[model samples]
Target: MASFVFKVIRNAFGIAEHVAPGLCGRAAFELFCRTPNPRSLTAGEQRAVDQAARFMAEARRHCLTTRKGRITVFDFKPQGGTRPLGTILVLHGWRSRTEYMKSVIEGFRDAGYRVVSLDLPGHGQSSGRRLNMALAVDAVRVAGEWFGPFAAVAGHSFGGAVAVNAAVGAVAGIPPLATARLVLISAPSSMPAIFEDFGRFLNLGPRSQLAVAAEVERVTGRRLEDFVGSVQLATVPIPALVIHAPDDREVSADDAKAFARAGDHVRLFWARGLGHRRILFDPEVVSEAVGFVTARPRLARVN
Candidate 1:
């Protein structure tokens, strides 16, 4: 298949191996600090954003664990009713903090599920030299001890890759992350493609793409996109709910459709005009995600 061949070629050239370790860390930090072009934020809109984030910081508790060493988490404990219908582990998109996605965390919780969220390495509470695939998975798995056998794991944008890396594969020999289902919000289909798209967005040159591949390779110990089938994920086998907005400027809807087709268990819900990050706030969007997840029941932890 074309995908398989791409995987082989991607690894051979070290597409993500253009530099020494941790370069992506530096790159990601620089990207995160730059203020996005603010688009018409009414004072009310800004305060609403601030208030929601404030709630999470005040409401959630921190849990730390050691995988690669001391991972930090913001976990919302079940409000003590039937062991929480289920716990939803949430991963935020690139260059965004966990607080910005409060609607997602609150959506799962309001629907009667516990929630665990992390600022992926180099992003939020977790200490990191950089943000890469392996560290991403390591952060989730370490937090897994506190949020074991979750009902489903959900991620948006780049975090979608982290969700897959954690749920379907064994990281550093940590007990395989156990989750019954998956939810990908604006998740991309391939890392090579993600790099290309992001590179174009940032106006990155060939050197930038090469630097990304190199940094990703260091963290994962393999080609960045080689993870296409690292677990059953390249062809997701578990129940997966994919939510994407047609108007997303960051990732292509066609790619999401392609990724959705890879899994028989995947159910795709396309929104007519929701923008990338705004998808989290759309009632119609949240309604679908919460419905899909809550429809599934719970079970005890395996290990």
Candidate 2:
């Protein structure tokens, strides 16, 4: 019943978008950025967002207002430890919050690293209902300022794209955020691929797709191609690990390969049956990612 209602709403909005690409495109774009119910949860689809929220309270919570919008952060410091070995910031994917990343967060915490995760603007407990890649990058920058000098940063899906942008300073007029290492899991390689996927999902005609792209460019003051992870990786010299499964249907495995191939400093890891989101919960993948982020560098710091 709920699924039927959602499809109906989707088709209605899609029709509106098809008829008037200018006005409707802007309105639908806002709705497109609106947070959605977590579609496929591991435990069960019946689990509520409130349940996830309650579970996430295991960590200290903070609310930060950035130039884009307010975002919620979950900070998990190593318990019963004198000093943290290092700090790692986790960025959740579109429509996902810190809670959904419990496995990764717990893995880092158990490894004696302080873990911090944030609910990007328009998602989770963050403020605002509209979001864009530019604003998402801003949220990352703001969070980095608040809890910074991170040894590493990790992100999944859409957040992975933003993390790359943040690291590379791809967003116009913003300086790059520094970090020792980066982990991108199941991320899109290019903004064009994402826009194409969005257009297919909306059943947008070619002309409507172009119109929507123009509107996005107008709003962000950035050419969409400039935000592609593969393109941005060329400017980033940091060590990185890119994880992707062959069966990831949302973002192709080719996307991960493209980003990884862009830089010799980047490494690719394959998690065979985990698919997309499930890879986050796989014990082996979790351990490997934690290990990468927490490993000490053999060389001394420059400064």
Candidate 3:
């Protein structure tokens, strides 16, 4: 049933592309950038959301204004009211809310670090309906300036790409994110690949694909290739961790290797059997991430 629907949509786009490449391209670009409505939570996800609510109840909430719109940030102090070791900023993935990152947030908080996390411009409890890497990077830059000089910045999936770009100053006009370390989980290394994949999914032809890319470039004031995560990570100059599952169906494991190979400053941890989203909740993955964030800076290779 789903395949049939997708085929119908693909054929529609195909016909439209031939009839009016310009309009079809614009439509494709809009659909490509459109943020999907949040999915229905599973029983476990619901519990996580409930626990996150309780966690947020004790947090210091801030509604930050940005060029894109207002965004909500939650500051979670170290557990037990202990003096925080340092502050860590967390970013959630596409179509995901900060609540979904409760495990990671709690891990950092329990480890004596103050954790600050926010919904991106279009996700969760934030403003706006559309989002892209440029807007996301700008949002992170604003957050960094507001609550900055972070001990580390960690992000998952799309958020991970934003973290890398923000950290490396990939987007023009926005200052690089201020942070000491970085962590990326299941992140795509190339923006162009994402567009290519989207085109394939929609069965977009040459003209439509070119049009979508052109529109994206115009909107971002930079080419999609400029947002390559591995290239940016190579210049990060900070100790970084790339955590990924070998069999992640959404993001290829090759992307993870690209990040690890970017530079010796970056290390990759393979979270076998966890796939993509499940990795966020895995106890071992959380422990490894927390330990890296809390530990003193050093180069450690993980096999």
Q: Which model scores highest in TM-score?
A: 3
Using TM-score, rank the candidates from best to worst.
3, 2, 1
TM-score of model 1 relative to the true fold?
Answer: 0.73
Per-residue accuracy of model 1 over 1-303 as CA lDDT, tens digit each: 987875664453343335522454346424533333333355765676577765676555675755554555777855545368878888987666677778788778778788888777666555554566666787787777776788888899888867776776734454458898888888876766766665654445465566666665655666666665223464448777778888988888875677666655667788668878888777777777778887742221111
Please rank every candidate by lDDT, starting with the best.
3, 2, 1
Question: Candidate 2 on 91-141: residue-level lDDT in tens?
Answer: 988867777788888888888888889988877778887677878888888
After superposition, the stretches of candidate 1 with alpha carbons farther than 4 Å from their true spots are: 1-49, 63-70, 79-82, 170-175, 197-215, 229-236, 296-303
TM-scores for all candidates: the values are: 0.73, 0.85, 0.92
**lDDT against true structure, model 1:** 0.67
lDDT for residue 259 in candidate 3, whole number 0-100: 87
Compute the lDDT of residue 29 as modeled in candidate 3. 88
lDDT of each: 0.67, 0.78, 0.85
